[model samples]
Target: MTTRTPQELAVPVRGGDLAVTRWPGEGPAVIALHGITGNSLSFGAVAEQLGDIDLYAPDLRGRAHSAGLPAPYGIPAHVEDVLTVLDHLGLRQALLLGHSLGAFTTAVAAARHPDRFPRVVLVDGGLGFPIPGGADIDEVIESVIGPAMRRLRTTFPDADAYRALFREHPAFTAHWGPHIQAYVDRDLTGEPPEIRSSCVLDAIRADGAGPIGDPETLAAIHRPEVRGTMLWAERGVMNEPQGLYDEGRLAAGDLSPDRITTRRVDDTNHYTILFAKDATAAIAEAVRTELKEM
Candidate 1:
């Protein structure tokens, strides 16, 4: 159970460099994608459990260290970025695992480039989210992301102050361990009184609004060529009872049973589904099983 340190590398893209964090291993490679406000380090816990599978997670353009990159930010742009990462690593194909917004990106990538990703795993996302009727995209983002959206506009006096804010979040208060701390710490940049999250608000807006709002992009999950599983969290953001994918929603039959399978991880929220020990173990086991089949 020793955790391996991730090696930070930069891959060239059309706009600029894409910052990647790699956990080296020997088995089939797995490319991970983080959430809207997340960075490559978001996969730290999952990587710790994946003993023999190589994992490459990138900070999508306009997030974390890749924040400097320009946009055309949306699902299509993110899909191309994933392709660039695969090409840069000389990988013909890899298992795709995406959490939250990353899940949306994963589905698009799998559909757009079936040869590049044979199997996909979505952690707490990828399924289309329900936007209440008459709500604008900004309202939807505000309601869904809540404090995270507010944090993007606020400047913390210091990194500790920023951590304090997240520490207060119901989702992280119990599961806030080393991995989560490291992920949050890496999210902050600049000096005191000016320190802010590395995620660019404009990029998040485009990414958050585009995939969830697009009918065609969300339909990618049902594509016959795209095979995948979705691991859902029982709790929603802030540890609320309403998760992103509720029982009713799952039973609603939006996803094709022939292409995608869904499973729920209990006692975890959206954020912890990929970071909590038991939850990460489940994700790791699912990943190992998928690789074995491949």
Candidate 2:
């Protein structure tokens, strides 16, 4: 893989500046969005594989460098921040690629604006999961996220300490590499003895309940103008047998085959899917193919 240096810039948002990372390329521009707890660097591995395309990733409010931004943080706030990025970059429209929570935000952005994004590629998210009625939001998040949510409450002494903690995660143990290490390193902030993930728990909780629970987001999946592909990891977040969207769940979702194409990526989980070489290659190819069709 070719090594590319990413340029970091701060774009003005409502309350503060939004940090963005741009991987320069000559091909058509692609805007990449990371998961709820993830920073812009979460797209680093995939961006490396997509050498022909210019990639822009932002640290959404309440995560990483953008953590200080005031909230009311949720899908709508993220959508507005994304539009600010698009305007800052002078892009009238760009191909959108979002992973996990980012995928939910992408769908909402496409539906609300319709003209800002020409194509959207949802990576391991976007389709609403089945949350039993009357289930507590906190419990739902705990069940779905498991250890990740627990880590948010703990503080690590340093980046190495944080990295060691993640190394123990089942989904990443086998595939742990420099890319994942760098991603984890960049996610940590604050001085030693107080260092922890930059993601704000409150913001995550709000975002979890907002887009995933919104009926309009599901309806956006069927919008004719909001066309894209949904990529599903065969494994779940913890490398479990069942993924976020299993075959049965996908078949029952509101997604129309004519609007969105769904494909399963083998041997990947929610977090590792974008980091895997084969999965990243497939994602990049899908973006290129969609851009051509447009």
Q: State which candidate has the highest lDDT.
A: 1
TM-score of each: 0.96, 0.96
Per-residue C-alpha lDDT of model 2 across residues 102-142, encoded as one tens digit per residue: 99889888888878887899999888865656777767887
Q: Give the number of colliding residue pairs in candidate 2.
A: 0
* TM-score of predicted structure 2: 0.96
| Candidate 1: residue pairs that collide | none
Task: Compose the digit string of candidate 1's lDDT tens values, residues 123-181.
Answer: 99887854655667766787887789899889989988999998899999998888989
- Any runs in candidate 2 off by more than 4 Å, and if so which? none
